[model samples]
Target: MNTNFNKMMFFYTMMMGTLMSMSANNWLMIWIGMEISTTAIMPLIPNKNFLSSESTVKYFIIQSISSSMMMLGVLLLLINSKIEYQMILTSSMMMKMGVAPFHNWILEMTEGLELMTMFLILTFMKMAPLNMISYLTFKNNLFIILSLIMGSLFGLNQTSMRKMMCYSSIFNMGFIISSIQINSIWWTYLILYSMMLAMILYLMKKMKIYYINQMTLNENKMSLKMNIWLAMMAMGGMPPMIGFMLKLMVIQLMLINKEYLISTLMIMTSMLVMFYYLRMSFISIMFSSLMMKWSMWNTEKSSTWIIMFNLIAMPYIVMLKT
Candidate 1:
């Protein structure tokens, strides 16, 4: 009960911090909020392993460096507003978000985190920084290109599910950043991505799956296997899945803005991402172990509801598109 209370307090602190940052009227308030969120999340990162300890330390160090950079940018901007300072602030937020070139820390941290912690980092923790970025003016074309390239190429050789998802997060960050100018589209993409990621992570956690190969070990749970693979395909932005619609919205917006080059790059990298998602799905479906009992076939009600929502929601998205 005591431990649970402590965790709840930390979680509340983290949420308050993020809310403060998002609603702040000034740079200093934003910085304070970011610091609060960072400090609050530290205790929540450590779990039942040495890896979690290492991850907590690494997370602290990285967040500290980014926060310091943000402070410096804010001070300089107050002294004399310059585009360089603005760029510095933008870069710091990108670093905090684990955007590529500053992305290695996220991959390492994901390896050690519990599924819930990882989910928060990938989705909720990103909101404050993303909101701050939207208030800045920076040429994100280079960041977009680098994130897509690195996320696609690095993910291909990864067998760890967490690491692969980190790469996918990086790739999706490019689209998120691209859509930032259109607030509605940006929120839409973020919400869709969060839902898809949460579904995949929850399924993986329930099945005790840490790696791609582990997915094949669930011998008698075909329905569960199907759910995981379908979630992966959705995450990879396959057509008819809600993820594809989300990406298509971003791409359409980019084309309307005459960003043909970035749109083309996005499409190409998405295909590469789809390849790995398909590979994982194929492995899950084709390979099975003979070690589990037949009675393990029961699917959880929550998971079934999630899958049913995915199926039911896609048609509405299609209709909206038409």
Candidate 2:
């Protein structure tokens, strides 16, 4: 194993911070953990060039501002614990996670990082904040609806794969927030979606792909190409995909509860997002030709464990039992 202290030390610190925040019994401890996580991740941001340095600076400014907002909200709660104050705290966490209007910093920051590092930011860094939001019983219908609308609409024209995925994450978080208001099943939904997302990013990392138009089916084996396309559809919540099932369940429950506006908006945004997903999918598929290549790029086979977990079976089985 490579013993790079810069990588190992910061990575472990990041994990430790996540655990601390998750297990903390009070908001103050959770804040400390979040700050630790924010500080730890900053050092890991790529700095081999000027753009990366810009990313690091933007990340620091955004995180510091969000952290301070979280702290202020918490302080107000301590002084006069009220639902109004709680909204401030929870909204700060949402800002930290880059839900919608607050999401630009992450887009800029992620654009400058290497793919693997960006993957970490997209998946792992948001975990603590997501859980914190879950714990807060946050149920802001307006914010959730806006996130879904803005995420879907903004992503319709994005060429950068990372930006598109970030917008998709914003859209997915709207469902997560909506679910928190409806049921406790967001945990399962989040797990299944996270795994599927990890699968897509892992493949993209191997391919060194950064743009939506760059995924040429001719460059990969038929099986791998189909799987990648399927993963993209899964992210978009196409029918039969685990993401689709999860969102369907959430929307159904919301409708039963008479949250018509949010549910209606959810459906609309989903249909719009699906358009871009199909566009990206078609671009990838149409590029296929019988071009012969005698050589392979990476001969290492994909991990069996990853393939197994990313399959729809896990969540589909849960849906079956439900």
Candidate 3:
């Protein structure tokens, strides 16, 4: 096949693999899906034009370890199958989803990848399915509590924006994982998190900035754009924004479920994380500068508008619904 055609094939294979993984009902099928997804993503990682080659190698090493662990756990589960096979299967899934002891590598690796890769792993893949899988098993499980505690603890002091979001994603995953105890209303939290993450990505893309220091309007005093800074504030989960509203709803949900201690811990983590968020937001928004005005570059204005609308409007919509 032609090189260009091969690249397309690889991308196609990745999508197919992801679809297969999501739809698979059996362990073997899920494993195949995972293998296909992993293989397909390998070639896409190495780029000659950017530092992505180094990132790719790091990603490969970490992901491969996790994938192998997941596969081994699944195989072990299969071998140990009994009348309670479904319970065994869920235990295996928990390992794959990076809950508890199996999750340490995930936290470490997310800090190593670039923003795009981090988004793909932690926010998109890791948080999303783990939310659902958390529901399929017992909440008080050792793995569940471990994931929650470590996720929150690690997220407390991240300075890098991408890494901070990565940890925030993990922290939020803890809350969502804890929600599995509720038996219902868990989907609401998942959906809210998904939407919040998408909006954050959108604002980041629109601003064409990555590092948290770049958005710091205070230190840069003479160099920051108002609109861009406002967008970053929204990303930090400020009031009147969808991110904030989603977080508030999650807190309320946790309280209703009588998860007072976990809720308190989560709130504390959020507040601790909020310091960086506020620092970033203040530098980006409140300290706007003429010298810092960012050019739109090749970004589509319509796309930015849509994202902005969602970030600003979703909270109001949720408030009205409640």
Top candidate when judged by lDDT against the true structure: 1
Off by over 4 Å in 3: 1-8, 48-51, 71-115, 127-135, 140-157, 180-195, 198-208, 216-231, 286-288, 291-322
Compared with the true structure, all predictions reach lDDT values of 0.87, 0.77, 0.57
TM-score of each: 0.93, 0.88, 0.71
Give the winner by TM-score.
1
Candidate that beats the other on lDDT, 1 or 3, i.e. the better one = 1
lDDT for model 3, please. 0.57
Error of 3 at 98 (Å): 5.6
Report model 3's TM-score to 2 decimal places.
0.71
Residue-by-residue lDDT tens digits, candidate 3, 1-322 = 1258776887688778767876788766766786786678667555443555665576566556656655665666667754444454455555545565556555555544444445555543443245336535444435545555665566556566666666566566666666565534455565655655665665566566566666643333322244444444554567766556656766777788787876777676666556666666666754445453354233455445644764667656576537
As a whole number from 0 to 100, the lDDT of residue 174 in candidate 1 is 95
Indicate whether candidate 1 or candidate 2 has the larger lDDT. Answer: 1
TM-score of 2: 0.88
Model 1 lDDT tens row, 75-169: 89888865589788888998999999999999988888988889999999999999999998888888899999999989999999999999999
The candidates, ranked best first by lDDT, are: 1, 2, 3
State the lDDT of candidate 2 residue by residue for 1-322, as single tens digits: 1249877999899999989998899998898898988888888886565688899888888888889988888888778865587788777877888887688888887778876677677768877887777777656787798899989999998999889888988888888878774335776677777777787887777666779767763376544555566777778878666667777877887888899999999999999888888887777656763533333222235644444444645466466537
* RMSD from true fold, candidate 2: 3.5
